[model samples]
Target: MNRFAWLDAFLGRLIAEDMAVREVPEASGLAPARGISVGADDWGNFGKSARNWNCRWAGCWAEDLGDQLRVHACFEKDHGYLLAHTDLRRATPILSSHAPYFPAAARAERHLQDLYGIAFGDHPDPRPWIRHQAWKNGEYPLRLDFPLAGNPLPATPADQGYPFQHIQGSGVCEIPVGPVHAGIIEPGHFRFHAVGETVLLLEERLGYVHKGIEKLAETRDAHGLARLAARVSGDTTVAHTWAACMAMEKAAGIAVPERALALRAIMAERERIANHLGDIGGICNDVSFSFGFYQFNRLRELWQRTSATAFGHRLLMDRIVPGGVTTDLSETAARAQIDQISTFRPQLGRLMDILNTSPTVENRLIGTGVLAPQAAAAYGALGYVGRASGVDLDVRRDSPYAPYHTLKIPVPIEQAGDVAARVRVRAAEISASFAMLEQLIGGLVPGPVCAPWTPAPPDACGFGLVEGWRGETLAFVRFGTAGRIARYFPRDPSMINWPLLEVLIADNIVPDFPVCNKSVNGSYSGNDL
Candidate 1:
């Protein structure tokens, strides 16, 4: 059965009634998207489908073409993507908000309101999302004529006047944390409304680090753009770069060589392993599990060092090129990586055994931050967070790209929907990734590292979707004349997962917030953009 068979059947009825436009699910990207373009009147139907279908809400985005504003809301069903869009051409382009249907759509649409001036009708909360009242009204930054250097004004004053909702009660109190943090972390403000230690509401205020990445990308070539995307979030360098490169390659109609595809997959898996190692360690450290922290930290250091020795960068930065990967592994490095996997398996197993049986760790994790599967699906949660919550969708398996299509990728899934389950899922994924890397490296194919390609036609559009360590990542790339970027939008998985953090923290005490937050591990930089 087509798991999303309900969509086609329901949409067909709309088309028959002349209320909905014909769907072109197989017409969005180089590899056709299972999507449709609905009129403003029918946009509500898409929202209904999202609420009723139990679909994974992937992302929502907007494009400002000076003359018109187009909004695209994305969803994932089974192995394919579903895109729903509505266009507005009037003086003030506006449409019904879909955020009521998909909670995750709120931030995305609110962002467009700040950047493109596209208003949403009936949006539940119409607050400024990314724009912190810095730019004056009518100054839509993402529009074509906006100056590259930004508005000539004094440095933006501190945005401290944000209207955080007040919860007034006899014993209720509020705790406001950073847009500036004490540790080596990015800027994001968190507001916690609590009664004693119990948190009643959690508010996340991000976008303090917005670097105008989308605006800056308009002038870059493919190679230059890849460098920028790689830094979208330092921890997810490979994932963001690969997604951007895939869109560039697809737009230019270039096919990467089989060997290059395999190498890309291997490098991606390595990135996944590296991040999970650090996060698992961070989770332990938060709970004062010092022994577990050191053990995981040591393993992560060694793993990243091996990756640098082979890939030429510690975090594999800029390793993924537009058409393919940047370099090949040396024979010595290849053999070492394989051997390391062999030796590391048992070490990982022992550590996992200890963590699994440790009552202290279990007490803090189990049922602490429970994310029901329905909420995960609504939030469009991805990566470990989604898998732990029983929303078992892995882009590598569901939407296979290149080598993952050939290899057996066993996505680790757990339904506990808590910190411990997230930890277990990562442990399982590390083992699977280690073995998969060994197979890919041992069966190495001899071929060129990059693909031969042609320049893309002006205004050509393409999209890339890759499974990053955090979750399903996507990049939308459109080319101008002479291969310059017209528009580039990178949808880091953090955009969707970050809001879910607020939902997860509810009912948890203030002291346990650190462990719960670490479990989700949303990227502030990624979400800020």
Candidate 2:
């Protein structure tokens, strides 16, 4: 059956039940998705219906208008996306939560509660997710009246008093690990309940580095917003920026030049390759496999240097603008990148052989940090984390845009959900990215890189979804008067994937935590934003 056929059928079912639904005209522009508005009372029923049809929960974000608040929930099945949103009066902003149907909604809802002051009825984890008391009570920074500089408390209190879930039992030890770490990584606290070396439970408390990216995004022009999106997660700069630009383009009803779309895809593939290589190396280093560590990092270094030669920036930051890309790929640089990918394949294959055959490496990784397929699905895990556990979904293949709609993107999956499975998935993704780069560069089109910008109507909204290196990245944009950003929310894949770490860490020894953590490598900046 056709994907849209399924979407139509689903809509009919909703309408039959007297649910308020209207098609969004902007869906025909930048994405192959559908959008609808539901009554606030029907929002929970929408979640029930989506769960009944086994829809994958994409993400949810809240927007604050002057007198009301709007909450949106996104779901996917096959190649079709359904965006359901409802408005609530700010005076009484109470709504049913979707956490009961989608476990992934728990953290996002808590985040919405903290930032928007919207009350979610029957939310699973009611404790604040992003609020560490940076602002005083009754101050919701995302609201229009809240100052960008923020109303600072005369004296900010210490954040040492969060009530963590205590596990009490004979011989059960609690080990608290950081909001500050010995390593040079972002701040996050992890509390572990262990009996000897075996971990009984692991709970993570993050939001220590929240930069208020959402609050800062308001009123920025398209170009400024795109630059800000690039920094949402520096490692996934290309994908995040492209997603942001895609959303803005959709909002403005602009078409990017075909050649620019090709260049964008090429840059995105390069980003996926670079991150996977660095992570694969880091995972090996955690297991004391120095040979694999050095070899993979060397490959990553070469890959990035080649990117620098091909693109102006090694990380390709700010390469994606509102309607298209900043620069086009030259024939000479394209040939160099093709050669780089050709040379990388053999070395990667050799490394895979070493990992597959080495008993010592297998002992450390094969069964460590195993996440059940059921658990993966429950949380709506994305990218390799979900794919390794058999939750086979990829935004590129599922909701293709521009060049990806023309290319044959392959999604690799593994049944094992352990650290070894995660490493193998990353390796396979690098190979797939190489294949895409070849297709994108070899069939490079000729045209202008960017389109002429036309301002969107006031209060127009659009969505952007991209398959980032880590997983499905989502961006929501609403344009205000004069084409300024009214609201911008970029849902990094890490937001959904971070909670899975706690699920996978249980039953593993403390020593194996490094490899498990490296395998997932959830971005602090991405989620904290």
Candidate 3:
């Protein structure tokens, strides 16, 4: 279906199901499609949309009446039902069946259950998703009524009798790897049941870094909330900040200047290139390719230095604001930097050729951590992981937001679904992003970078989605009369992708864990938040 027509049909389906539909223009000047009003509560307004083709149209439901609980769904746009607030609260048997429809929804529902003490009656896997035994059965820390200061901390949940499915056979043995590891990475435990050299089953225990980011957002204004979003994951600061600001501008009906949109796109592409470069090197390092590792790491450092000089932060934190960008591009500096990238191109090409021909590297990565196309779909994986498995979905290309529509995005996909494929995808994406950067700089326009945004009216709701380096990042925000945030939900791609680690690790040997883990590379900090 064509874009506009498809949106109309989708909206018709929602309207038939009793949702109040509204066609709203792009408030942040990004020009997404229609926004439908889902409902409203004392906390603020609620809404939904299928703004981008690759994106799921999710329900943004919030309640500020007392507990200030915010609940939402991030299901596929074409294949899910919208459950009304009244229907959700009928005390009817909680339907646990939604997970089967959208696997991403499973993690989100579990998060709601943990923070709001709401029951997902029939939730297929209701096994205490994010509630890590810090609170009792009746306590919900996210509730507004819950004391913000000096709340008694509950004891950690006891580990005695906690159940994990075991795989058994004549030669099977279990190997456990950390909720704490040797690396500086965040905590998560992986259990592998292996028979000789092959793995029979894999299970993961996460949630070691949950900091109640959503709950904290309730107490901050837009700027404060932006800071919180930037901290969702250090590596994904630009993406998170952009999503937060997009939501804020939408809520306030603020239109950012065209120049600001261009600058945001430039930073986003740089972020993508930087991350891909680092990951490529890290993946090589895992496989003992010291030469490749050193070269790629050096390149990555160069890219980061460029970002630090251009954006004032190596990771570009706080570079995005509600009405546009926090900084403007320096044409003279950008031109000089483009020259550096041009010089680095041949070096990157030589390194790619060397890595592609390295037999040892190829042997380890070619058939490891394979995620079949169907399995990837069932898990709802995104970003490089999904692309490697043949999903072929990229939010920038499929959604065409901002500068992406003006400059068509090229999506690179592979069917291997293995470590090698992921590495290749990253390599190709880095090249593509560099090309995009060149084009963006060449077409640089001059104008105001930010538009002034007044505070949003009380009870206004907004939703924002950005194609982060990892995948699609989404934020739902609601504002109060006093210009403070009433409710906020930021859904990171890690939340959906992390669960797939368990599925993909099955049947692989314990020795291959490093390559497998690097292939998925789900962000623990992002998920825990």
Q: TM per model? A: 0.96, 0.97, 0.88
For all candidates in order, the CA lDDT equals 0.84, 0.88, 0.73
Listing every candidate in turn, what is its Cα RMSD in Å to the true structure after a full C-alpha superposition?
A: 1.8, 1.6, 4.6
Better of 1 and 2 by lDDT: 2
Whole-model lDDT, candidate 3? 0.73
Task: Say which candidate scores most in lDDT.
Answer: 2
Model 3 ranges off by over 4 Å: 4-70, 77-87, 90-96, 154-161
Ranking by lDDT: 2, 1, 3
Between prediction 2 and prediction 3, the one with superior TM-score is 2
Q: For residue 499, give model 3's deviation from the true position in Å.
A: 1.8
Predicted candidate 3 versus true structure: per-residue lDDT over 1-529, tens digit per residue: 3445555666676567565544445343223534333433211112223322344433323354552233444434432222223223423213233454455566666776766666666566777766666666667777667765425456555443446778767888988888888666678777788888888888877777888787788858888988999999988888888888888888888888888888888888888888888888888888989898899989989888888888788888888877888888797668766986797788888999999899999988888999898878766678899899998677787766678888868888999899899989888888888888888888888999989868887877776778898987877787876889988878788887887777778788787888788878888888878
TM-score of 3: 0.88
Query: In candidate 2, which residue ranges exceed 4 Å CA deviation?
Result: 15-31, 154-157
Candidate 1 overall Cα lDDT vs. reference? Answer: 0.84
By summed lDDT, which 10 consecutive residues of candidate 3 come out lowest?
Answer: 40-49
